[model samples]
Target chain A: MEFTLISLLNGVTYGLLLFMLCGGLTLIFSMMGILNFAHASFYMLGAYLAFQLSAWLGFWPAFFLAPPLVGVAGALVERYGLRRAHRHGHVAELLFTFGLSFLAVEMVQLVWGKAVVDYRVPPSLEGTLFTLYSTSFPVYKGFMMLVSVGMLALLAALLAYTRTGLIIKAALSRPDMMQALGHDVPRIFTLVFAGGAALAGLAGVIGGNAFVTEPGMAAAVGPIVFVVVVVGGLGSLLGAFVASLLIGILQTFMVGWDYSIIDVARLFGMQLHSTSALTRLSLTQLAPIMPYLLMVAILIFRPRGLMGARS
Target chain B: MLEVNGLHAFYGKSHVLHGVTLEVGRGEIVSLLGRNGAGRSTALKAIMGLARAEGSVKFKGEEIAGMKPHQIAWRGLGYVPEDRAVFPDLTVRQNLLLGVKDPKAPGRFRLEEMFALFPRLEERALVPGGVLSGGEQQMLTLCRTMMGNPDLVLVDEPTEGLAPLTVAQVAQFLLEIQKRGVSILLVEQKLAIALDISQRLYVLGHGRVVFGGTPAALRENAAVRKEWLEV
Candidate 1:
């Protein structure tokens, strides 16, 4: 039971990290109508930048500086890359982002080399918070939770209260109408793309230390983030939040469970353990597939996902 | 205030507008009257550079033949699309707020003034636009456009698919806007409503302007209406 609870918290933390990355991705996709494959790459860049900055400054300052730097990179890409590719239609835009992701991953390797960089938790937040039975949660993880909550609150407030936020909200609903209403929609798109990248970057600053910071980390994290967004539903923030938490808890609990199909079958008195390839597969190996399985089920049952409505 | 000379607009390979020329003076309400498929909406779109077009368009004595839709809008011209493009997820108050254009704006509309203009909208200011009836959505679209305080407004088929009472209300709203000295380019199918509100009329058919004159002249000329507008 303690094991389960510990793993559940572990899953929630990871899920929150994914949410940080995916929330920006959802906003970008809705506002720009481009599936930005480079989004994960940006997250990776954030980690690398934070790692580099943390060596000079501290972890907290690196956290502040890295996101905006990544945001500037995102703004430049919008001005040059995405905007140029936008003239070629949705497929072209997707391809452009896909190519950019490929390039960014390769660039990371070229600059940082192939090995994983040691991204340690800041000394200030390096200890345990408290013990429960035999398990203790790390102080750094508690700090991560605090930071994520603070970021979410800041974003929610900005989106809800500011004029620019109002424009973004309006644009997300009706982009052409936004254009007609005399808002410089291209400028708005640039801002949204940058803002999204900044969020991803911020996620990277925290998540990089929590997870492993490597050139190939994007490949590992990217598909899961996509699954989170798709499971959450496109163009819906509330859906994203729900899916994030759901996936988090699901992943956490699944990892802790030690039961197998064969064991369950034996318990139920259906002990037909013929040597099939399916039965040979370990429950440990199935952990990675859980989110994808859930994604497929969601897709089959509800085509627009949990919150999306076909218009 | 606006002039289109030899305007040519195309949709893919099939041409929708061909060599159309028209003009609207300052503070005048000009109506483009035609039956469906007569390129009435296309003309407004073409002039606004919303459609793929090739021709000469002049506004305020400056040639604006090949500008983007937003650029055209930024030049003090606003378009209300035929479908009444209201942001369904937004509240009525938010919708109105979205239309204010000035970069350094200072409370463009007193909420009371707008409420006085459309009491129904005021009553449901916080309601999401999707829940509103078709008539209310149309009013919202118009009110939203006027909120920008534009120099010239391009309104496409404002009376389409509305109840007669709502149509009358929209007409009154247009007149009120005109009273505020805003020039209007109205693309409409209902000839009666078009004639009621417009100072001049242009009838289009097969991507060309078949007739252009006053409402009285258009009413008297049976051949023009029969050829271009009558079903």
Candidate 2:
């Protein structure tokens, strides 16, 4: 029972983290129709940035500082890099971001070395939160949840209440109309890219210690984000959030379900040899791949995803 | 005031507008009339910087040949596309609000005034633009452009696909825009509305101006309309 509760806690926390990173990605995709491939790299950069900043002025200031820095980096890339690639078409834009991801990984390795950094939680948030059944929930994980919830609230408020938010929401429907209405559309695109980068950075700062903070961190968690976005659908925020939680909790639970393909064979009145391929297929081993399989199934059946308006 | 001297446009390598030239004096309504493939739409698009153009296209006496579309819009020109291009996801009110050139400044039109003028829009102000009827979308498009307080409007086929009653309403709105001291470069297929509203008219054929004169002069000449404008 404690194990189930702990896994649930772990799942929700991880899901929130995924939402933070994926929310920005979905917004950018909806607005510009470009799947920003370097999004997770920004998250990785955020962690490394926080690590460097925390070394100088403790973790709190690093939290405050890292996101905006990543935002500026993203804006510069949007203005100087992506805008130029836009004329070549969507494929070129995708290639640009893909190349950017490779560049970001190389840059991280050059700056921080190829080894993992000692990016621990601050001394203040290092303690444990209230116990969940027999399992103790850490204060840091609670903080992460708080940060994600806060960001979700902030994003919701920004999109619902602000002028820029209204424009972005409108842009999702028709981007060309925005230009005819006397808006600086290129500037708005830059702002969206920057905002997405900032969210990813925030995710990185919160997620660094929660996961391993290393050069390979972006690649490790990056494909899963694509899975989240694909499973969430192309242009829906609510879909991203729901898909994130579903995938997060699902993968965590699958890891706990020690059932193997042999058990299914036994239920079918068949006996599998120990060395057979079916015998080696365990749910725990398939946990990481569950998202990919889900993506394929979703694509084959419901191409628009759960809440997507378009395929 | 706007002037296009020897304007040429290309959709990639396919040249569409070949030496099309016309003018709209301040506060004057000048209509561009032609069949579908006669480069009438291309002329308006070129002036708006939406199409690649070469040659002297001047607005308010300043050369605006290579300026971006939004930059041209910021300089007090507005375009109302033929399809009634409202942001479908936005509320009608939000759609109108998006049209305001400067949110901080009070433009020529008011939100209250727009709603008062078009009561149908006021009734459906909170509804998403996608759900509105074609006629309602036309009104929203006109009012939204008015919110910008443009010096001149480049209106393209405002009554296209609208009900006859809605067509009359659209015609009435075009006159209303002109009365408020804004010049108009009108593009329309309906000869009656163009002749009724325009001070002058230019008839285009094969990407060139076949006739450019007063509405009376255009009426007096059947040769130009039969050859260039008539099916």
Candidate 3:
């Protein structure tokens, strides 16, 4: 019971982090029709920037400053780089972002070195928030949950209540119509790209210290983020949220279970098992690949994803 | 007022509008009548900056030929596309809200006024635009454009695929729009409705204006209609 409760809390915290990344990625995809392969790279940039800023100015200042800086970088990228590639079509845009991800890694390595950076949670949030039987939940994790949920509420309100939000929702489906309605479509595109990058940066600031701040951190989390977006559905923010939580919880629970396939089969009254590696594989060993399996299943069964409007 | 002189629009290498010339005077409804490929829609697109075009497009005496679509729109031009392009995921109210250019500065049209004009829109204000019936979508599109409070509007095929009763409602809506002092450059296929609503009519043939005159003058000339407008 203790294990389940602790794992559930950890899973939700992790899921919220993934939600931060997925929200921006899905929004960018819906608006620009580009998957933004460099989204995770922006997250990495956020972490490195936060690490540097925190060293000089402390965590609170770094927390506020890093995301906007990343946003400016994103705006510049859209205005100068992505906009030019956009005219050449989707493939060119894809390749441009794909190349950008590599460039970001290289830049980070050149400036910050390939080794891991020491980025720790703030002293205020260093201790445990609560004890669950024998297990303890860290205050930092609670802070992370607070920030993520706060962001989600803020985003929802902005999209639902504001005029800019209405225009963005309209532009998501009909950019041409939006332009005809006196909206500067290109400017909106730049703003959205910047906003998306900023969200990713915020995620990086929070997640980097929670996990590990390193050059390989983006790559490590990148594929799983994509899996969440795909398994949720393209361009559906709610889908991304749900998928993030689902995958996060599933993977966390799987990692906690040490039982092998043969042991499960034995419990089901099928004790005889072969010496094959698949039959003996533990759930903990399979946890890392579980998201991929879910993605594959979703693709085969519901190609449009959990809430995708189109196939 | 809007003016298009010697307008030539192209889709890639294929020229769609060749030297199409037309005008919409202040507080007037001018109809562009033509068959499907006669460039009626392209003329409107060129005027709205939706198509690649070369020539002079003057809006309220300002030369806006090379401007982007949104720039042209800022010059007080509203466009109602042929496809009834409503943001399907957005609520009807949100769709209308998007049309307002400056939310802080009130336009000539109001949300309340739109609801009054089409009570059906008020009934489905909170509903997603995709689920609205075809006539409701058309009404929403028309009202959405009006929310911008444009000085001159380019309305393309607003009555296409609508029921006869809805068709009458659209014609009535156009006249009502004119009553509120908004000039209209209407692109329409239905001859009777266009003849009824328009102050002047321009018949387009093979990307050029073949006839331009009052509705009475068009009624007197059957040859022009047979050559250009008759499908």
Candidate 4:
């Protein structure tokens, strides 16, 4: 029971982090129709920037400044790189961002080296939040949840209540119409891309210390982020949120489970051979690939995703 | 209020509008009559900067030829496309609100005035735009543009695919727009409606102006009608 409770809490914390990354990706995709292959790279850049900033200016200042700096970098990339590539069509734009991801990794390696950076949770949030039986939840996890939930609420309010949010929504489906209605469509695109990058950067600020801050970090978490986006549906924010939590919880629980296919089969009175590798492989071993499996299932069953308007 | 001189537009390699020249006076309802593929819509797009065009497009004495669509719009030019490009996910009220350029700067039309113009829109104010009926969407689009309070409007096929009642309502709306001192450059197919409402008319044929005269002169010119307008 304690295991379930602790895993659920941990899962939620992890899910919110995933949402922080995927939210920006989904927003950028919906607005620009570009899947932004470099989004996770920006997340990595954020972590590295935070690591460097915290070293010089302390954690709080680094936390506040890193995301906007990443946002400015994203804006420059959109205005200079993606905008030019856009003239050649979607393939060129995709290739540009795909190339950008590689460039970001190389740049990070050159500046910060290939080794993991020592980024730690701030002293204030370093201790335990609560004890769940024998397991104590860290205060940093609680802080992460608070920040993620706060970001989500702010984003929702901005989109729902503000004029700029209304305009962004209109531009999502009808950018040309938006232009005709006196909106600078290209500028709006740049702003959205920047905003998306900022969200990812903010995620990295909180997530970097929680996980390992390394050059390989973006690549490690990148594919799972895509899985979350796909399973949530391509452009549906709500779908991404639901899928993030679901995948996070599923993976967490699976990682803790010791049961294998053979054990489950035995329970059903059809024991598999112990010599078979597939039957002997434990659920804990399969946790990493579970999101991909879920994505495949969702694609097969509901191609448009859970709440996606488009297929 | 709008003058297009020697405007040449292209759709990639294929040139669509060839030296199309036209003029719309202040508070005038000028209709561009043509069959499909006559570059009637292209003329509006070029003037609004939605199409790649070269030449002079002057709006209210300012040269707007090389301006972006939003810049042209800010110069007080509005365009309503044939497709009625409503943001499907936004609520009807939100759709109208998006038309306002600056919430602080007062426009010619208000939300209450639009709702009064079409009570159907107010009834479905909270509903998403995708679910609206054809007539309702048309009203919403027209009202949305009006919310910007543009000095001149380029309307493309406003009555296309609409029912007879809706068509009459659209005609009434056009007259109402004219009454508010906004000039209209209308791309219309129905000659009767054009003749009834338009102060002047131009007929487009093969990417050029084939006819330009008053409605009475157009009524008298059967040859121009048979060759360029009647399909």
Best by lDDT: 4
Q: Show model 2 residue runs off by greater than 4 Å.
A: A262-275
Which of candidates 2 and 3 is the stronger one according to DockQ? 3
| Two-chain DockQ for each candidate model | 0.74, 0.74, 0.91, 0.92
Give the Cα error of residue A151 in candidate 3, in Å.
1.0
- What does candidate 4's lDDT look like per residue over A1-311, in tens digits? 99999999989999999999999999999987879899999899899999999999999999999999999999999999999999999999999999999999999999999999999998988888899889999999999999999999999999889888888888988999999999998999899899989999999999999998999988988898899889999999999999999998999999999999898789899967669788889999999999999999989999998888787
Candidate 1's docking class is: medium
Tens-place lDDT per residue, model 3, B151-185, is 98999999999999999999999999999999999
TM-score of chain A of each: 0.94, 0.95, 0.98, 0.98
Q: Note each model's CA RMSD in angstroms.
A: 2.0, 1.7, 1.4, 1.2
Q: Lowest-scoring 10 consecutive residues by lDDT in candidate 4 chain A?
A: A271-280
| Interface RMSD for each of the candidates | 1.2, 1.1, 0.7, 0.5
Please write out the lDDT profile of model 2 over residues B46-139, one tens digit for every residue: 8888888998989998998998888888899999988878888789999999998789998989999999889999999999999999999999
* TM-score of chain B in each prediction: 0.96, 0.98, 0.98, 0.99
Top TM-score prediction, candidate number? 4
User: Candidate 4, residues B181-216: lDDT per residue as tens digits?
Assistant: 999999999999999999999999889999999999
Residue A80 of model 4 has an lDDT of 98
Name the weakest run of 10 consecutive residues (lDDT summed) in model 3 chain A.
A264-273
Off by over 4 Å in 4: none
Segments in model 1 whose C-alpha atoms lie over 4 Å from true places: A264-277, A280-282, B106-109
Q: How much of the true A–B contact set does each candidate keep?
A: 0.79, 0.71, 0.95, 0.90
Clashing pairs in 2: none
Preferred candidate (TM-score higher): 2 or 4: 4
Per-residue alpha-carbon lDDT of model 3 for A84-123, expressed as tens digits?
Answer: 9999999999999999999999999999998999999999
